[model samples]
Target: MTDLPVRIRPEIAALPPYRQGKQAGDEAFKLSSNENPFDPLPGVLAAVQAAGSFNRYPDASAARLRDRLAERHGVSPDGVHVAAGSVSILYQLTQAAAGPGDEVVFAWRSFEAYPGLAVVAGATAVPVPLTADGRHDLVAMADAVTDRTRVVIVCTPNNPTGPTVTQAEFDAFVAAVPGDVLIVLDEAYAEFVTDPDAVRGDAVRAAGHDNVVILRTFSKAYGLAGLRVGYAIGHPSILDAARTTGIPLSVIAAAEAAALASLDAEDALRERIDAIVERRDRLAAGLRAAGWDVPDAQGNFVWLSTGAETLDVAAAFAEAGLIVRPFAGDGVRISVGEEESVDRVIAIAASVVESLPQTHAGRR
Candidate 1:
């Protein structure tokens, strides 16, 4: 590799950049990114179209959207902070709370962005392995924390793998950590969760855990992925620090308006969410019947731990006109998409599952 003209941090240079799911061709279904497959509600589209003049900067504070979210979550406007997306807020929080000589802990094989965020903050990343069934090992995560630890992130219905942390598990983990440490609950896919026992961030905050910060996004269930609006609910003091680190005017006018309109039309959106949930369950069942050990998927996706067969299986999916996300030797994550895509995915899986090694973990 060639050397840079200016001196750059070796760690930053060594880190791999975040990769998004592959885009699909015209005829293929894009089941790679965990995006909501529904179209924007009429109200939401109108709000974005009628948003403030493009000539001026968006409200630097996004006060109206903050106020709306605060009311819904039973917090003051100051307790809420909005940004381009929850992932951006993650960067801001890491920058605000951790730095050189500090550490950030989260589950490995979870969100692909966590490790990079820590490195970007000039902090060491401590990634605890998930359990064999794909749920977070919260006990191990709490044990990983140390004096140098500044932040702990818990991603529920963990991306790529769909199992969630229970309320009991979250409570126990929070009790294990010191109050001074920041606990970020990255619930980007929370709206897609269906399990009654899964931990809810709103309930956690209501129970009075000031150290906990709940991060949510309109990108998924609200179909606002293009606008990139997301927010955090936490103590004002904690949010204030993240705000200081945030890029000014990152949450633009159209995004804020779209978010507010989506909130108003949430009832209609839930119908769409319900349909996806139904489809996700059926798809998982079909894969299981085909002799695959699919995890308990509560989110709008399913994980097939194909192990060494990952690339081959993903290739088969693409050949079947479905674009899925693969993690080399790990597994493949196929998002719950159009009604027809579910049957198409399982139809392809029926053939691929048989070709897996008999001893593979994903094979039942």
Candidate 2:
């Protein structure tokens, strides 16, 4: 038979798929993905159960949830836009703003979605390297933006590395960017940040900046990763642009109910966060005491910078029935979870680090 028309978009053809945490076997302790190990809050579960009429479509506008979010964040409903998840909102924003000849910029080793989204939107991705301390090199990122730059994503408390950009740094970076270019601040791990100087992107957006968009998700602290609900706070025009891109209504329903319920269960969520934070500190101290290069992880996870052979340590952990997210040559990221899980991860990490040759050095 004659070859079927084999034309596909060149950008898509050349793009690499985003890698997620591996789920090898049921026995594996799944710490590869930075997901909250706690169960959904009681209120959130009740809300989901009450939402039994699956026959009806969700409120496309997500009016109720939006209003709740507005109150919580001290913003108007017009500034809020809900989607299936933060990633979905990001994809829509990329498609809406980035196109041929435009460039998307973000820090290297940040959220993995930035590059793929840029490629999908037919834009050039400019990845600036992170600072020596593993925080976003905001100055370098701002300097990387040019006339062709359409979107710049800043993932603070970054995925692999847990360091966050300070408020002053973020302010300076935003001031340096062109007003027309969209600045996406992906704050997926915002809830875990205890630093008083940490940048709260939502507050930045609320201050009347037309170019800034703050993306947040219920998947983290709310224990609603499976619900796939997230929202963006930004200028009304930007929100309108993203909303124009259609999202599935069913996902929206589950997200809205769960998010609203999560809001009501703030105390329970706070307790969960406290526990995770304590565990994170304990694990970090434990790893450090064992002579491992563990950083001050402000998120619900820790990073072990074993330099070039991070994969070896990751494999060692895997062999011990622990699945960790390895950034190949970069480092291994281990998610903080329940007390027992956290202790087990630290124990395994200590053993792995000790077993590795002393030649494998750690970086900042």
Candidate 3:
């Protein structure tokens, strides 16, 4: 075959591939994707079961779900944008706000998708490393902004590292950011957070910040990962821009039904959240007690900083029929799931830690 044109965008070609946890079939305890371990909330299964109009197309506007979300968040329906998943919303946001010469800023190792989304949008990604304590270095991120900075993503109770950005820190960061730059807060795991200091997206919008967009997903706390529903709350104009670049409408419908059902089961969902929190704390303590350096996790997962031995620990867990997420050069992130799964993970982790050699060289 003749040589293909070397016309592909440099950013797209240079982007690192997105990696997910190993699929479920190979392992007994799969706690890699940060998914809610609970079964679908009451009425959720029935609602999805009732969604049988496979012949007809879904509502293009996602009007009902938009209305529900708007009412819940106390915003006009025009200010809401629904998509197949929050990641789709993120992609749309990048397309709407960043391009060619613009830059997108976020904490390094926060969300793997942020950098890839920035590259695809033809924008430069400026990643500010997290604090030594694994929290977002908001001050450093704010300082990284320049005239070309078009968007910034703050992932509260951040991925991998679970500490949240406090309201005070968020308020200060917002004040420091220029009005023209869009700040997208990805609160995918918001429902699981119980800290008084955690920043709520609804509170952010109610403060009347036009440049801010708050993203939420039904996948985590809502227990709707298979349905793929997520949304954004922002200025109407910004929502309009995101809508123009988003996915098909049917995915939107299933997501809407799942989300509405989830809201209806709020009490039950909260109980599940409480369970997850309890499990997370117990798991973290168990890991620490076993001599693993586990972070204070506030999300549904805990981080283990094993340095170069991260992959070895991951392999050991897999060998024991467990699955966990390993971050190159960073650490491993193990999700808190059902009681049995959590126990299996703790057991596997304890064995892995105990078996490791004392020195880095010995471990290697």
Choose the strongest candidate by lDDT.
1
Ranking by TM-score: 1, 2, 3
> lDDT per residue, candidate 3, 145-253, as tens digits?
9999999999988998888899989999999999989999999988878789889999999899999999999888888888888889999999898888776574645
User: What lDDT, from 0 to 1, does candidate 2 have?
Assistant: 0.84
126-171 in candidate 2: lDDT tens per residue? 9999876678988889889999999999987888788888888988
In model 3, which residue pairs have backbone atoms overlapping below 3 Å? Answer: none
Error of 2 at 84 (Å): 1.1
Relative to the true structure, candidate 2 has a C-alpha RMSD (angstroms) of 2.3
Clashing pairs in 2: none
- Candidate achieving higher lDDT, 1 or 3: 1
Model 1, stretches more than 4 Å misplaced?
none
Listed in order, each prediction's TM-score against the native is: 0.99, 0.94, 0.94
Q: For candidate 3, report its TM-score.
A: 0.94
1 versus 2: better TM-score goes to: 1
